[model samples]
Structure formats: structure tokens, C-alpha cells
Target: MVNVAKAQDETTAAEANTGVAIFAGGCFWCVESDFDHVEGVRETVSGYIGGKSDNPTYKTHTANGDREAVRIVYDPSVVSYDALLRAFFRTVDPTDDGGQFCDRGHSYTTAVYALNEAQAALAEAAKADAAKVLDQPIATEVVSAPTFWPAEEYHQDFHAKNPIRYRYYRNGCGRDKQVEALWGDQARDGIGKK
Candidate 1:
């Protein structure tokens, strides 16, 4: 007889081995694309967070104060959260309180949604380190994570699905140029770099 209960336990154990990290770095499409390239990242889902709504759509979430974010599922055994934090800081303009790159508004601001106290501490430490490296104030907020609402299907992997449009938008926004000016080689280490 097949051990169904044992199989179920094994599946649960496999899932427990993974961890989630959420971050808002302007346009979830861009953020998702960036983290997807990371070594230990298992999956990246574009979404909205830090808002008060049951089901937030792209249209309504921004107006509702929900920030566009990415939910990263990663293998903790393969990569540490501190490494992810370093990558996150380098990938986005953390000094801009107004917004990131050309994207302006509360929804486009950068933030790290820490899932727990440990993650929050790591994020804070990372922020301090980044500020020291850049010699400027870091505006990225490390806030407690809330329920993450996955964006519409089309928003997911928009970069891969619509490479032309994605490239155009990314270039027009001057994301890479701005990041390079801010972080130099660290910016090139991120996604959306040519």
C-alpha cells in the first residue's frame, strides 16, 4: 500500500525548507525580473502590498496606497537573507523618497517588507551598510510584512512576455543609468542591465 500520509508529510517538509522575502522597488515587473536572476531564488511573483484592501488590482492598488512589490521564494539553504538584502539595496535607488526612477507615487516607492523580527533586523543592518557605502541617507523602509496580493496574471513575467515593451520602458525610465550613477558596478550586478 502507498504511504499517502508519509508522502504528504514529505511534501510539507520540502515546502518548509523554502523562505519568502518581499520588497517594493518600483514596478513589480522590474523588481520581479531583478530577483529572478539571483542564485537562490526559486520564484518571483509580482504583487501589491502595504495597503488596506481585500483584492487590489493594479489600477486600484496605487490609489489605495498599496505599493507595487515582488514576493520572492528562495532556498534559504542555498542563499542567505543578508545576501538578498545586499542585492535588493543595489538594485534600486534607496535614496529617493519621492519614488524610484521615473515612477513617482506611494505605490512606486522602495521598501523591504520584513516577514519577521530577524529579517527586519537584517534589513535595517543592510540599510545602514548601504548608506555608509553610498555616503547618503537610504530611504528604503523596513516595515512589517502584511498579506501579499498577487497581481493579475498578465503582470507576471511581463519582462519575458513583452521584452520589447519592457526594454523600451526600462530604457526610457533611465533605470540602469540612474542606478549606475548611484551604485556603479553594484547596479550592473542587478537585472535589467544591458
Candidate 2:
């Protein structure tokens, strides 16, 4: 009953010829940073989804119950949806039962928010492929995207806007190390392998 196609169209200006992928992978800061590095991705916005409230704020989502998510706008001509899918599985613990490393909560879970039927199938296929690669069972959810409420302007590009602080926080939090440990060879080699 979830209309991902409609959500996708609303999130992305399809007439402008752009495709969007909404993903919830732990911290939005990390998620936005990851996609920012990927080629063909135009922009990544931190946000909240899969909640009961409208226009939810970070405080409301984190303090209460809501999924922390990111909205990614990209040119499909340059990067296929499959490629993004690969990156998603590689960057986060797909088998961690909704919660990502260091950040445990419904708000910090890993999820693939499908914008359409095609995206839903693609997400499932990607997860299946990842399951074959890893020993653990995949736990990443492939669900219809919820109403996205953009986070505060300060949270938009926290990494870029505050490089030193961001680096310090990231390093101190041990995110990179955990990601490497979980990903292992996949992290070193990149997430291109299917």
C-alpha cells in the first residue's frame, strides 16, 4: 500500500531528469558524507522518515521514535541505481538488525527507502547479493519511503562546514574503524563487486 513511486517523484524532480535514493544508514552525517564522495551523486540531505509526525525535527525524531534518513539526488546517467545500492550495503552493517554501529536505536538504523516498485526490487536483489558475499544474514530493510522532513540547516553539511570538528568527532567515535572491521576486504576493495 506504500507508494514509493509517488514519494520518489515528490523528492526528485523527475522532469528535470534526476533520480533519487533515500537511505537510512545510521548517522545522517556519515550517510551524507559517504554519498558526497561517490561519483554522480549531486547532493545528499540529512532528514527523518518513517515516523508518525509531519515535518519532524532532529530533536523530535531522535528523542522520540523516528528513523534517521538521508535524501540522495543523483543523475542516473552517470551512476546506476545498482551502484548506489552496492555502496549502501558496503558502507553499513546490513545485518545489524536495523541499528548501525555505535548508534543503536530505531532512529539510527540502516534501511533502504524505495521510491518505487523498481527500486524496491533492486534493493532486495542488492541485499540478496550482499548476503551471498557476507557470512551473516542481511537485515537491511527495503521499505517504501516515508514523508521526508529536511533536517536543520546546521546539520545539512556538518562535515564540510566544520571539517576539523567533523574529523575529530568521526575519529573519536571510531566510525571508520568499525566500518573497516565490518566491511573488511569489501571496504578496502570498494563496493563495486556484485
Candidate 3:
């Protein structure tokens, strides 16, 4: 007979080896959608971070200084954090300090919440490289990771749940076109094969 409990334990152990990276690149829905397509990305959760309030909701987080962010669970062995950083910078306009694309607000600003010293260093280096490549100062900030409050269940995988609305919003926002113009062929390349 199969040892179900042992199998479950093995699965848990395997998942324990994964790493987490959090980022705020404008709307959580769009950020979540973009990371979901990346290889080695196990999962992406839409959430709010860098806030003082406890249990922040979408309606209150922006006012509370929380930014719309995504928690990415990925296999480090398969995809390096550096690669993820490259993909992230390519997906959003790092030069925009006010916000991303059409979204203009504190909550929609781009950020990289580094979970550790190493990640922070990598983020800084990535920011510098991105600025050099674009020949413009990058506005994205690399800050320490904070308590991430997951957004409501309705916000999770929103792109998949509401394809039409997601398409409309994405196209209307001109996210892809802007990214393409910014990063050229490198745009969305982070979603490359595992």
C-alpha cells in the first residue's frame, strides 16, 4: 500500500526548499499576472506591504502607505533571483516614480521588497544596471521586506478569473506596449522556458 502520509511529508519538504521574493510593480492584478507566466515561479500572491495598519484591506491600504505587491514563490535552483530582477525591471517602467503606466498613486509605485541582505544587494545592482541600460535614472526602490498582508481571495489570480476585464485593463493601461518600448526584446523575457 502507498504511504500517503510519507508522500505528503515529502511534498512539504520539497516546497520548503522554495524561496520567496516580494515586489510592487503597480497594480497587484497586473503584477500577479506577469509573474504567473514566469518559469520556475511556483505561485504568486497579490498582497499589500510596507504599511503600519494591521490586516489592511484594498480600500484602506493605500491610505495606510501599503503598496500593491506580489509575493512570488519560486525555485531558486531553477531561476536565480538576478534573473527574476531582470524580468521585473523589464516588465515595468522603473523610471516612473509617481506610479506605473496609467496608475498614479503611492500604492501603484514600483518597489522591490528584499527579504535579506543578499537580496537587497542584488536589487540595488539590478536597479543600477537597469538605469544604465535605459540611460535614465531608475525610480524603483529596494526596501526591506515587511509584513505582507495577502489581499482578499477575490484578488488572487484575478487575471485568470476575469480574463476579459484583465485584458481590457492591461491593454488600456498600455503596459505591454510601454514595456516593449522600454526593454525592447527583453520585455517579458523572464517568462522564458524553465
Candidate 4:
């Protein structure tokens, strides 16, 4: 069995120096791409989580109730979790339980997978703040993090590796349009702007 604490520490190379956050925000590709633009984010891995099956793959994960997710490794000294939360809120339509944008499925639902009690509280606070801003109840779930199974290698850094395709997909999906409409001037606030 893997020692989760040790695995998390090793994942970032410096246990005390690096911080990790997991987000199931619609499509993992877009979420990974967005967080990659954040200032303190050291790395982002596309993955699947909150599933009944342990070894669910790309094709079958959704059937197991897994949602596409991203695991972000960041430096708290550079970006606070609160900032990450705020950034997260701006990136997606938190009120949409039916899925995000053109993506319509349970796997496309948004969630903040809090790795600890602190994160859980922060997520809830962020959701409330977002709700206040949008004047709507947030549908995003804040739950304790479960095992994050990384997606196939081809899914990693998809935006970087396949920029043209990624751009086409993003545009066709109307993700930016929707986020801009929902968050207005603050859409993607903490990404490259950070």
C-alpha cells in the first residue's frame, strides 16, 4: 500500500515548500491548461477522481462515476490557497450541475477536492463568495480528496503538446465565452494576470 502522506510529499519534491490542490472542474484538459497559467503553479497533471473503480481508464472512468480532474502542485510562498480558490471560481460556471459549457455529463461536473480540513473550509468560503458575486447558489462540490489517478500520458499537457487542437476545442466548446459572461471583467482573474 502507498503511504499517501509520503506520496504527496514526494510528488512535489519538497513537502513543506510545495502545496497541492485537486480540482474536478469540467474537462481536465481545460482546467490543467488554466492552472498552468497561474503564477505559483509548479505543475498540473490531468487525472480522474471520485470514482468507484480504482483502475478506471479514459474510456471507462466516467462509467465508474469518476470526473475528469486536475492535480495542481504550487508554491504557497508564491500563491496562497485562497488565491487559488478565487482563481478557480473565476474559471468555471460554478452554478452548473448539468456540466460545463458544451460538455454535458456527470464527468464534466465541477468540484473542489480538498486535501485537508483547511482546504475544505477555504473551498466552501470561496464558493460562498462566488455565489455572492454571481447572486446564485454554487453547485460546485467541496469534498475530501480521494485518490487521483493520472490520465494517460497523451492527456498530459494537452494544451502545450497540441496547441492548435486545444485552441479549436476550447473555442468550439465556448468555455471562454461562458466564463467571460459569468465572471465579467474578473474572468480568469488569477491566471496569467498573476
Candidate 5:
């Protein structure tokens, strides 16, 4: 069995010195690509989680029942989790609580996996704040993190590796348009900007 405490310590240390934050925000491709424009994020990896699967693959998650997720390693000193949460809230429609964008399934649902109690609390508070700002109850789940199985190498940084296809898929899926519609100007102005 893997020691999550040790792993978290190692990851925290890596960030303490390197400013990295690990995040799984819906589709790894969109999460990875959106954070790419953020000035502080150092790296992002697409992967699967919140399931009882071993060594999950992209096809398994996308085609079968795995979650199309991404692990974003960023610098908290450079960009706080609050900032990451802001970007996350902007990029995806959290209220749906369903699979993200064109993807429709439990594997693609909106969720925030916390590495520790502190992170979990922060995510919960963030969701509560969202509920207050939004006129509806928050449905985004804040749950204990599960084993993050890295997706196939080809899925990593998919948008960067395939810009033409990435744009085509993103535009065609209507994710951005949907975000604009639900969040309205809030999407462009950030969560509490309205």
C-alpha cells in the first residue's frame, strides 16, 4: 500500500521549493490547457481518480467509466489555491454536477478532490461561497482524494500537443459557450467579480 502522508509530504515539499499545486479539474485537456495560460502553473498531468481502478487509461476513462481528470502541479506561493479555484469556477459550470461539457457520465462529473483535511475544508468553503453567489444550491462534491492513476502519456498536455484538434473539439463541444451562458459575465470577471 502507498503511504498517502508520505506522498503528500513529498508533493508539498516539491511545491514549497518549486511552487507546485496538484489539481484535478474535470477534463484534463481543458484543465491543463486553461492553466497553461495562468502565469504561475508549472505543470499539469491528465489522469483518473475517485474510482476503484488500477492503472486507468484515457480510453478506459473516456470510453468506459473512468473520470477524465488532470493533475495540475503549480506553485501556491505564486498562485494560491484560491486562484486555482477561481480559474476552476470560471472554466467549468459547477452547478451541473453532471459530467463536464460534451462528456456525459459519472466519470466526467465536476468534483474537487482534496489531498488533506485543510484542502478539503477549503474546497467545501469554496463550494459554499459559490452557493451564496449563485442562486442555487451547490452540487459540486468535495471528497477525499483517491489514488491518481496517470493517464496514457499521449493524453498529457493534449491541447498543446494537438492545438488544431484541441480547438476543434473544445469549440465543437460548446463548453466555453455553455460557461458563458451559465456564469454570464461572471465567467469573464471571475467568481465574485459581479
Candidate 6:
């Protein structure tokens, strides 16, 4: 059973001071870029999760059955996990079981990886809220987190390093358009920037 508590009475320094969230919202580039605008998000790392491989990479993660995901490290005092969950749902198409936007594959599917029971509960509630708002069944999975293998250096901070290419890919993939179409005015509600 999930513990469903934000923290244990005894916690490590990092866990006591900050929060970590793992979200798989299709393209890591787009997801990383989206969270960059959030207020308390200190770091976002592009990575792979939900796979059987001991080592996953950009070239082989898909074949290893891993999906693209981002690890968000944020100051919980400034922005709660619930807010991050809301922002995540607004930025991605939760109803698209196939994949997100122009990306269509098993690795592009959306999911929330909860590190603890509390996170799992929040994720489930957020998912339910999103489903209620959309009036449709959401396919996004809210499950326990798995081993999070960070992507190579080149993939890390790809948006800031290669802005034009990132923008081009995001635009070409029609991610923004699709998110807006699905979420409307609430498309980017929790995002600090427009």
C-alpha cells in the first residue's frame, strides 16, 4: 500500500528540504521547456523511465521499451506538488493514449511517476481533476516511480543550448497547438509565464 504522506517523520536532508517529481509528457524537450517557465522549479532533467533496460539512451531507450520523461526538482515551499501536477496536465494531452501531438509511439506516452505514497495520491487526485475538467477519460498513468536514468549531456538543457532547433521541433510537432486545443484558457494556467 502507498503511504500517502509527503514525508516520513525522519527524512534525508534533500527530501526534507525539497521535492522531486517525474513526469513523462511525450517529448522531453517540450516538457523540459514547459517547466522552465514555472516559478519554483529549480531543475528539469530529460530522462527515460518505465523500461527493462539496465542502461537506456536516446538511441536505444525506445527499443528498450522506455518512455521519455523529465525529473523536476523544485522548492516545495514556493510551489506545491499539486500545482506542478496541475501544470503538467495542462501542458500535455492526457487523453491521447497513443502519444502526444506529432509523436506517436509507446515511448511518447504520458505518465506520472510518484516517488512516494503522498506523490501517488496527489497524482491520482490531479489526474481525476483533469479528467473532470476535460469530461473525458484520461489515459495518463499515475504509478510508482522507477529507476530514473538521466539522459546524456547533449539532451540535458537542450532547449537553452539549442533554442532555435528546440522551437522548430516543438512548433513543427504541433504540441502547443494541441495543448491549447485541449486545455483552452487553462492550457498553461500554472505556468508563471505565457
Better of 2 and 3 by lDDT: 3
lDDT of 5 by residue, 1-194 (tens): 22236334326434554543345556678877887777667777777876555776765665545566666677666777777776776678788767778877787687776666666676777777777767777666776666677788888888878989998988998888988887777773332221
Could you give me the TM-score of model 5 versus the true structure?
0.84
TM-score of 3: 0.90
Which parts of model 2 have CA positions greater than 4 angstroms off? 1-8, 11-15, 188-194
**Per-model TM-score versus the true fold:** 0.89, 0.89, 0.90, 0.92, 0.84, 0.92
lDDT of 2 by residue, 49-89 (tens): 88877878877886656788888888889988888988888
- Poorest 10 consecutive residues by lDDT, candidate 6: 4-13
Model-by-model lDDT, in order? Answer: 0.83, 0.80, 0.85, 0.87, 0.69, 0.87
Tell me which of candidates 2 and 6 scores higher on TM-score: 6
Q: List the residue pairs that clash in candidate 2.
A: 4-115
- Tell me the lDDT of candidate 1: 0.83
Question: Candidate 6 — which residues are off by over 4 angstroms?
Answer: 1-16
lDDT of 3 by residue, 128-185 (tens): 9999989999999888776788999999999999999999999999998998898988
Error of 2 at 53 (Å): 0.8
Model 4: lDDT to the true structure: 0.87
Candidate 6 clashing pairs, residues 3+ apart or interchain: none
lDDT of 6: 0.87
Clashes of each: 0, 1, 0, 0, 5, 0
